[model samples]
Target: MLDFNRRLFLGLAAGGAAAARFGAARAAELRPHEKELYEAAKKEGQLTWYTGQYQAEPSEAIGRGFTTRFPGVEVNVVRSTSQVAFQRLSQDMRAGVAQCDVFSSTDHSHLAFLKQNERLMPYKPQNAAGLIKAAQQAADPDGYFQVTYLGLFLMGRRSDQVSEADAPKSWKELLDPKWRGKVAVGHPGYSGAITSWCLAMRKLYGWDYFKALEKNQPQIGRSSADPVTMLNAGERQIGAAIPSATTLLSISRGNPITMIYPTDGTLMVPAPSGALKNGPHPNAAKLFMEYMTSPAYYEATRPFFSESLRPEVPPPPGSRPLDEVTMITADPDELERDGQEVKELWRDTFGV
Candidate 1:
């Protein structure tokens, strides 16, 4: 009877141990770099990342990369347009829900707004010193946000439809009678990139530039990436403001698309990432902030032709180097002042 009782007790104990191991999600086992943060994040077990930087497919890949690196931490990505993401974050805060741990948007002004409100947690990335000068300049001085990527609006077209000589090599060429009704552009209201591009163009040329372009009746879309599909489908002969990364990725896939770095200048979008101050998963969020600056993160982003913010990571193959391109970007203050005005103007002009 004694032996029977002992055996039964051991069996129960082992079953209990097994249940603890696999019955539910646990904290991720800490790594050398993330050890200090691992315990806290492990307890949290998951983080919600609100991203306006990438679409669903690429965002999921990034989340998977984070999970693969940290065994116990799961990344729940909320991907949407930059303005939409901002609106959602705003709504969540108003509702008193700490649902978002990290927020990344292509619009730089959002960082200033969040910081002004003390909504962002000040955390310097361990890899900040290794980033390029431009990327460094884009980061918040107090370390509330860091520029993770740089995407540009370049002229792109169907490779078969437009020969090299026939392609519009400058922004001025887009006004040619040839591309009228054949050019596609993203709406500023829906795309942050477009907002900046509109602001920059208005600064450089004035609202009259948009007025002239309006006469062409360009096909407008919501996402900056829309031009890639529209051009590939031969629905448009040219794109007025296609994202360089999307165009490069499409070309790599054998799509009949070719990107052009305009002789005049290209609109550069510096995407910023930040951790929420009152996040549900603070440790996980900070760890993610650090992870984004690591080479491994750049490696994961390479497949999608993401423009690298880290100096060590090379530009996506076949794309022009940043230094060689004339990239125009608006100051955060300028964005704050004129961003909404540009979007409202875009809607009025395009009527979409």
Candidate 2:
């Protein structure tokens, strides 16, 4: 297997390529609490946030807001895919670099990994109890690593090619012969969101469901964004368990797409945030984590159409309301333990 750190660097570079393509935006108007956190960041002098949330515009917007809030503190935002981010963070911890101070990614396993390594400290940000209870429970009892947000959805092209009623409403629906070559999915091995969804299936339907999915000859893409791209381009007619908002964002650009949370079930992934146990800048790291979990900082990224785990926050436009969707539950710890076995099973069935 490739070294996780190198892969992370490559993913970060790939995302940086996108950032270069889209100019960064200044922080959107700040609310009162955001202003206070911004001042705190300024006092800290520097903050670093490494994330797997790879949408370019939102990433830049986040960086810009941090910059705006803390003019004195330079925010170095490293954007990468979650697989690479998790591997790199693991390698960094082992190598003693811990380049990331505050780590936020869609991968809950990485959050579990950080916990096992004892690389995270407990900290309940000011408003800890308000977020989703499942997400809050995932955090350290004392509040070390908490879920920042989660993205749960299914999406496809808006073109009449696939009617809303015909869209895949359950995991089993993706395996229909009609979608044989038409189905596209983000790589389960590489994407936390995709993997989390798979894990949910394993927990809900058992290993047999995954075995069947693997046989479906699903086309797996390296970029988490590719399935949406393929659907928007009309290269594929259906995709499931992707970030629906991403598909909707394409729709806004006239790419012709629509999304729905499956009635049968949807897997909610807590995009987690944590502080390195021995980070280069501990205080700044804590400040950043505290700020991000805060509602003010949370809302700043909403325009990108992803869901925050906080219940008080609303789901983005064109996305199903959380309560309306059926959700499957999987213990993060159980998923972490069985993760490798799960990936191997995927390869065996899918021939990936």
Candidate 3:
């Protein structure tokens, strides 16, 4: 809420510089398994990562950071929305082509489905132990997939257009007639975060919640990040399901946007990543998995406002601690069971 002052900005800069130094130092000395994987991965030359978690810029920056840390191995980043990435991976499987070495999606149910189909390789990362307890608990018990990215799905408003006093305080307030034509959201069929959000809303208030929201005529986009884009461009006054990291980055860049932790509960989005069983670069995929969970990975993503999985690495500036907010999350079993139904209902309710 414009509280990100010069002092905080300077502190963030200093923190980033220190993280970078630490990453460089860590890269100079690799663990035994890492060194062995590096030798095998170097022979493979590269790994293809199908990522549906972060934006294109941040995803590519992670790829570059991985390449910088482990020379001679390249990372090919293919970024898309969660559903789209899943569809592409499904197509590749049907065609018998091993294009994606690693799969990272915001929807945990996707990993569940893949594991059920025996599409994911079962390999636990050594760095997984370094993750926070909550993150560790989110991982698959059998090690088929692990939570690699954590974010919050909350509300946001264009500060210049909507005063803080007038903004909606809870998810139910979004359906008020006064906010008609002013709200922006993402389609559950296209975004995994939105799918979880829709599921949570349904569980709490029933499908009538969205039925009422439809009366407001909210603008819907493909990605959950799109609502922030709409608010930043002054095209929308409110965002019903916005990613906190994206909004914080926009605010830091002087965008007239502010985050609102809904009084009901903020949605906790835990994006999971796994290696494909039939991937072309098996060893490289394993190495990339290790890199994604390491401190160096958090360092590359801290500037983009990505939440830290490791307790040693503090969260980025202008972000709320997870403990301070009431969080709503759907488990993989629930997500796997209801994901398709949510998508179908979303299209029926919104006619999109």
Candidate 4:
């Protein structure tokens, strides 16, 4: 009877111990990075990322990369035209919704507006100090905005119709009658990067130059990514003002396409990222910003045709060496003052 009682007690104790071990193992299933992300995200419960163009592809890549390193965290992305993203952010802000976490946009137009309205909070990413000098210098004084990436070229389908040597090397070359109606343009009103390109042309050549190009009758696209696809399909043999990624990705896929980094100059527009002032997931947004901006991680994950804000992150393959290209500089003040007027002019001229 004593032995039976002792055996029963030992069995019950071992079962309890087994249950405790299983619970502890289950708790550890959440990766450390995931635990960090989850702890930060629980305050907000969700994060909404609004970004420009191919941002979805890279953003998803980053999200997968993040999840691999840190399980248990999920990231949701809302990709659209920069104009659309800004409008949504603006609307949410005005309505007191406080829905989104991270706002990833190209150019300083939205950044200027966010600052002007005090809609952005000053929260630098954890890795901000390790950014390249250019990237660091481009960040807003109070950390309201930070430069993300710089793109430098336009692309086209490499049909026998255009020779690599004869590609447009200056803005003036694009207006040649032979290329008229053959070019694809993203509506400047909706694409901040394209708008920046137009603004850069205005600064570099003259306002009259844009007026002349308008007369060339370029076919405007809805999303910036559309032109790249159109060029890939050979529906439009030439892509106007496409950034490096569109063309390079197409070329790598065996699409007969080529990119032109205008010899006269290409604009280096910095896409700025920030957290909404009253975002739903402030902590999660900050964590994401840290993830996206980390020099080490960014270098490891950068697309083959893009430039990372980290000097340590090498320029993608087939890109013009950073030193060789003369990139037009943008003035945030000027962009803020004239973005609407310029966009209006673009609308009137292009009918987009």
What lDDT is reached at residue 160 by model 2? 64
Which digits, one per residue and each the tens of the lDDT, describe model 3 over residues 1-352?
A: 1111233223333444444344422333777888999999999999999988999989999999999989999999999999999999999999998899999999989999999999999989998886656667778999999989976889999888889999999999999999999999998888899998888888889999999999999999999999998887888899988888888999999999989999888887778999999999999999999988887888799889987776556677887655466677665667889999989998998999
For model 1, which pairs clash? Answer: 27-42
Q: Which lDDT value does model 1 have at 254?
A: 92
- Kindly list the per-residue Cα lDDT of model 2 for residues 1-352, writing each as its tens digit: 1011223223223433433354332334655554676566566678667788656677778777655555676767887778777777777767868577888877777877777768886666765564545556566676768767666646464466877777776666776667767777786677777776667777667778766666666668854677887787677777767776577678778776776566566665556788877777766676677657655555677677765544444556666544455555455676688777777777777777
On lDDT, the stronger of 2 and 3 is: 3
Model 2: lDDT equals 0.66
The list of candidate 2 runs beyond 4 A from truth reads 1-44, 127-135, 309-313
How do these models rank on lDDT, best leading? 3, 1, 4, 2
Give the alpha-carbon lDDT of every model. 0.79, 0.66, 0.85, 0.67
TM-score of 2: 0.82
Assess the local accuracy of residue 167 in candidate 4 as a C-alpha lDDT between 0 and 100.
73
Tell me how far the alpha carbon of residue 260 in candidate 4 is from the true structure, in angstroms, after superposition: 1.2
List residue ranges in candidate 1 displaced over 4 A.
1-33
Candidate 4: C-alpha RMSD to true structure equals 16.9
Ten-residue segment with the worst summed lDDT in candidate 1? 1-10
Q: Tell me, what's the RMSD of every candidate?
A: 15.8, 9.2, 6.0, 16.9
- In candidate 3, clashing pairs total 0
How do the residues 1-352 of candidate 4 rate in per-residue lDDT, one tens digit apiece?
0011223223223423443343211112433553576686765555777877345676677666655544445567788888888888878877878777778777587886887788887888756775655566667888888766555545454565677776776667877887777878787778887777777777777777767777777778866667888877677767877777766766778887777766666666667888887877777777777766665446434564566555444556676555555556456666777778888888777667
lDDT of 3: 0.85
Candidates 2 and 4 compared by lDDT, better number: 4
